[model samples]
Target: MLCEREKYDKISEESNRKTGDDMKIIVSGAKGQLGYDVIKRLEALGIQAVGVDLPELDITDADAVGAFVSREKPDGFIHCAAYTAVDAAETEKELCSSVNEKGTLNVARACQKNACKLIYISTDYVFSGEGEEEFETDSPKAPCNHYGASKLAGEIAASENCDKCFIVRISWVFGVNGKNFVRTMLRLSETKDELTVVCDQVGSPTYTEDLAVLLCDMIKTEKYGVYHATNEGLCTWAEFAAEIMRLAGRKTKIIPVASSEYKTVAVRPLNSRMSKKSLDENGFSRLPAWQDALERYLGILNEC
Candidate 1:
């Protein structure tokens, strides 16, 4: 059996054979966890991928985004930059809307003018956490929090502005390039004997390294529409944490708590289970199971 890195290399090599080597893609939020991985995957597949973020580019500034897109004239624009501070978004509604909603609009418009395919990274938060059922691509959107609403608005902006758009909604994302729940859990286990995690919320985790391959594959094709992408299996946060401890060979115990008992500034969705039927319908392969992805992620962390 091949390790995750070896498997990834094989996948990239096979994908490279099917894709145009001269394809150019620009990734916003280049410094972010997802954006960083997407660019890496694109480059690995022999695509000319450029990353732009922060002081170099501001997605909120329409003129700046337009000029950058026009100058680069990329074949595709992967927009990953957003205000993702879920709890902080409540107190910073204006800023969140500016970065997520307005900023996404700017990127979409730039892509439209440049005739570039726009791949907008979205969240599963667009759906209401009312039931235990999985959310489909056409599910009714009722954001549970400000951040969700902002991302939902961004979804609308991307679809409305860019004719050629792909909106991929992912949940519980973890990656090597930045901070995430998995890293936090490992870091806490080093000093703490136990940690409390919410048990009510359920969702599949998305490893950026795995998602990057899927995203790169999508960018090469003309499958333009909405899709939900996450690892295969699902688990509550507490269950996820316990599995993390088990995999990492840690002694830390994960104490499960009902979401109602553990109050938060922003209400997290109770049901983040999303259907991957869209990916199947579009001839795209689903990501590996969450457990498998986590194990691979831990191995990568150990090497790093």
Candidate 2:
């Protein structure tokens, strides 16, 4: 599958249909939060997208990645796998680096060799907690936590390796398929009378479904390069929890807290909101605000 980039570019340029049998896409980290949603959307689009996750494919194994891509020979590769345990990274730095950093290098090398257009899922953790403005695509990375550093490293590796790559950086993602902040709040609201959430940290809360739809569109359009894909608008964790409670029709009391109030091994950026300039400039539209996405997600959760 490691063909010349020029060859694949020529072939891709000839293909105009975005969501049809004309494209062969592979989604790595298929079991994770974002990966699961990506696969679902791909199916809905009538695209023959295959998923490779744990037990099926371990990205850290370079030989495994190469063999899988070689056998599949997919036209596009969406990498959602990463070491995402933020606090755990304090002790598992080696593991995080191996997966998020070195593992990304391995995948990029394979994609570069195969000439597959790579779409990598990154995080807002790359920025320092210094600004209140939304982070631009060109912002310098200054990760404050081990998890962030590891993910940033992965982004760098992938960008340097492949010319036709999409680095989608998102923040505070929630979905029906995985462990997330919203689910945590919902669960805690059930057990606790009142919750004290950090109000100082600000960022957008993204719904995986919205992101999935955007990803599908991007792949179809062959829109490559770094982009910030998340639900529009921003709020603090406390406000986000309040919105979740309101949407779920729950009466869980939410109390505000500062970053210092809740100490963790990793320091979260005070400002994690990202600019959607790149997405707009690339001909893709911004996702709906967080509240709208949450209502839809809650509606689905209720159905499930």
Candidate 3:
């Protein structure tokens, strides 16, 4: 369910008490799904979160970013902005590079200039998905798609520029305020009788709200390292879609498809699942299972 602003604040406050500090956080791409969750979570914790997106601030503009960071001087900056259209990115390489690479560079540089901690959100696409085991934090990044390559470039820029930076890689993120697999299925189910989702790609379907909480927790802990964030369990696209339909009480048949059959502009990893061992080793709490989170989401959708 979409949490009301006040309710979200209360939860954030609880999270802040655990973290022990209500920090001033700057969130770029505040209009996007992940950014929206971040902003709401920050407000809940009684933290001051300055949201900058589009007209107010574009990460691509170096001067504007520097000026804003200078003025806000936030305790931490959560760089959530990115060029996220995976298929489209294959053709719009330059545009993708401009935002995902150069734009990230601008944000990272600004944060360094302000001496603020940075939490740069990245994707699991950095891995080539050759093995069955989950990808480690330090695994060599070998992107198979342009989108992943651009994000990896951003990660490189951020790591080089910021001293206290946490490059978090998450997979299959879905949320209330953005376009995602769940939303697409729900929308399509209303018209079509069945849906074909690729089952070969295995990974966690992370809920943005849960991820927002984790991000706040990580920032408060002062853990300056790379980490993976996703729900506790994993599943393929077909399995995930089936669960979504079942929860929503929709009788849409989900047909399983192979990666090759569902041909797109960009190539996807067969196994984008990431290991949460880093977070576990670091002593943070584990998020609820993906199935549990999906049930909660369905409850919210039913209310609407």
Candidate 4:
């Protein structure tokens, strides 16, 4: 018998599409990588967008969040703000929880009050790094580290507080506006002739530019729920490092090392392979292959 994938209720065609010059959307973490691309994309599409970040907005402050939302009165809010330092999260558990969970709750409440569509960006770390099988949207969440646990809590906070929220899980994201693996690899190649990278962990790399396009598409429709979004292919860290060298014409060699050889403050998930059936079913398009994305990324770097 075929293993049946549990399906989610299909997104109906009843779209409360946001249009016109007066249309507005607010983006959290607008200074970050994904948010930068998203705001750029929105402007390209002729949509009015406002970004909130840094000293102007502290999401953990309920009053600030509420006032901001009330003032903007946006049709949609894309929440990309997060405490992303993986290893640091282990020691800074309290801060991580406050930002990822409490901050998210504040945002969700604000969104609910404004009747705004919320998009909460999450990570694949919520799963244990056990097997090689791809993780489904409804996969059991057994986060092994503090960071993962906090993010999982954030997911719950966002979903529970806001009825019109989209929980989008992504992994290995790279982009032009912020620091990412591609830039790090290229920087390392400038000095080192060889590098040892972790080979055990494998996942797809998400290009923020591509992801931003998909997000814009989602904000247009009211099909809000949980989903996974990433580039179309997968690779180990070592393989990805080697590809970076190849693209940039660097002679740096990549040596594959097991997870045990590399020590970190926090545990990492090995099985970050997420199934995109949800996106396909929800009438969303998958991102381009990682290899294609990497090449374009390097090209962009070269021009810069």
Candidate 5:
């Protein structure tokens, strides 16, 4: 097997030869689940990536963002930084808006100034969470919570500020680098014999590793527009927990319950089914099924 540095050189050389473009990229929120995976993917492709997070690079500070972008002058900018505390955003609306909206605007503006392609990571919460049919890329947005509203505002800011921008919305995300549903389920099962999960709310679970690769692929092309990218297929939170227990060989029973049974500070969307037709029409590679992603994630977790 090739060493890390050797793998990086091989991938980077091949990417450069094929694309004929230097792969210099900047990733915000570099320590986050998605951002960390994205940087790893870029490095595997032998691309030059600079990862920035809070304290190092504050996205809410326009001058700081501008200075950093000007200094780096990367070919692409992946804006993964955001205030993602869904429930806390209800009371901390200003902090959420400042990070998700104003912070995104600052990054978008920097991309515009530096002539860099922008890839802004968004969320499925932007929808109203009431429909049965899958939401199209142009579906009307009516965010039901402050977190969702803030993210939607960020999306709008990205579009308005940058000409070459791609807004990729994901749902039910899980990764090794951060707290997610899979980890939570495993932890709960350790302490409890049974758990109640909402069956009414449905959405796809997106593995950050898969999403990172897709984001890298998007930056390679000029398919600059809104797109819905998530692991294929959908299931309720109860169903998801059941699968987790099944894979882990845990005997914890998952009781199905309505969304009302579990009250949260913010309302979750009932339907997070987003159509990937835009990805197909735009000639982008679609992600594998959620089951496959789950299994892969579990395998990785076990090894760790």
Candidate 6:
């Protein structure tokens, strides 16, 4: 397995050489888990990246988006802003739609007006919870929940509105800058002697830090289309929790349960397996295994 330093070096060398110096990129939702890491990665490569979120840049406002893009005049725009609260989205349908659908349209329009390439971050929820086969980039979307439906709308908007757009879908994302499963598990471990996680919900756990590197690399090329990006292995939520406990050297027993055991406002996909064929075919490097990513993430958590 390549160490984090080696991975960074490889990506930096390849992307910087391809993109060259002084390439300005605009990143929306800069404070998001993926966006934070992307900005850091770009900075490491000596690239000029401008990150915006909330009050500074309301993606839902078309005029605000157009003004920002016109002022920045960036070469590429990474649209990471989205209403990501899965369960909350069920009750807040309008808010979710406004951000994920209309907000994305606004960003796409801005990108088109500025002649900027767009890299939109998407999710695995777009697929229906069916079959064991990996969902390809072109797989038909059947959203199981409000969050998924809204994201699918965003994907469509980005594709239709922008001439140069790369819609990259990720699954089970965990990062330092946002609330995620990993952090929740660790927090729960502190108070609870045991925990129950869903075993039927299976997907790849993507580390935002690893994903950020891939996004930075993808923006340098013109391979505009849909792509599925996640760590190379698959596991259920139960298995993921077990690994996290094992790495942290915690003795908290992890109890496995079916999706029916836990009730939520929104439904989750049972199978979120996605194929990375597009990444390989397009000559982009795939992320490391989930285990490796977990270990590295744990090390970072320890430091914090």
User: TM-score for every candidate vs. truth?
Assistant: 0.96, 0.93, 0.94, 0.93, 0.94, 0.97
Cα lDDT, model 5, residue 48: 92
Tens digits of lDDT, candidate 3, 1-304: 5433334446546756766765789999899989999998888767888998998887899999999999998999999999999999999999999999999999989999998999999999999977888789888889999999999999999999999899999888888888888888999999989899998999998888888987887777667888888877889999999998998889989999998999988999998879888888886666678888788777776787
User: What clash pairs does model 4 have?
Assistant: none
Local distance difference test scores for all models: 0.92, 0.85, 0.87, 0.87, 0.91, 0.92
Clashing residue pairs, backbone N/CA/C < 3 A, model 3? 1-300, 9-44, 12-44, 12-45, 13-44, 13-45
Question: How many clashes show up per model?
Answer: 0, 2, 6, 0, 1, 0
Q: Please say which candidate is ahead in TM-score: 1 or 6.
A: 6
Candidate 6: deviation at residue 46, Å? 0.8
Q: Write the per-residue lDDT of candidate 4 for residues 1-304, one digit (tens) a residue.
A: 3111101101111222322334688999999999999999788777788988988999999999999999989989999998899999998999999999999999999999999999999999998868999999899999989989999999999999999999999999899989988889999999999899999999999999888877877887788889999888889989999999997999999999998999899988887899998998987867778888788788888898
User: Mind giving the per-residue lDDT tens digits that candidate 1 earns over 1-304?
Assistant: 9865466557656766877558889999889999999999887777898999998998899999999999999999988899999999999999999999999999999999999999999998899988999998998999999999999999999999999999999999999999999999999999999899999999999999889998888888889999999988999999999999999999999999999999999999999999999998987878888999999899999999
Q: Which stretches of candidate 2 lie over 4 Å from their true place?
A: 1-21
Q: After superposition, how far is residue 294 of candidate 2 from its true place, in Å?
A: 0.3
Give stretches of model 4 more than 4 Å off: 1-22
Instruction: Give, for candidate 3, the lowest lDDT window spanning 10 residues.
Output: 1-10
Those runs of model 1 whose alpha carbons end farther than 4 Å from true positions after fitting are 1-15
Rate residue 227 of model 5 by lDDT: 97
Superposition TM-score, candidate 5 onto the true structure: 0.94
Candidates 1 and 5 compared: the better one by lDDT is 1
Q: After superposition, how far is residue 125 of candidate 4 from its true place, in Å?
A: 0.5
Q: Per-prediction RMSD in angstroms? A: 1.5, 7.0, 3.3, 5.8, 3.9, 1.3
Alpha carbon deviation, residue 234, candidate 6 (Å): 0.2
Better of 2 and 5 by lDDT: 5
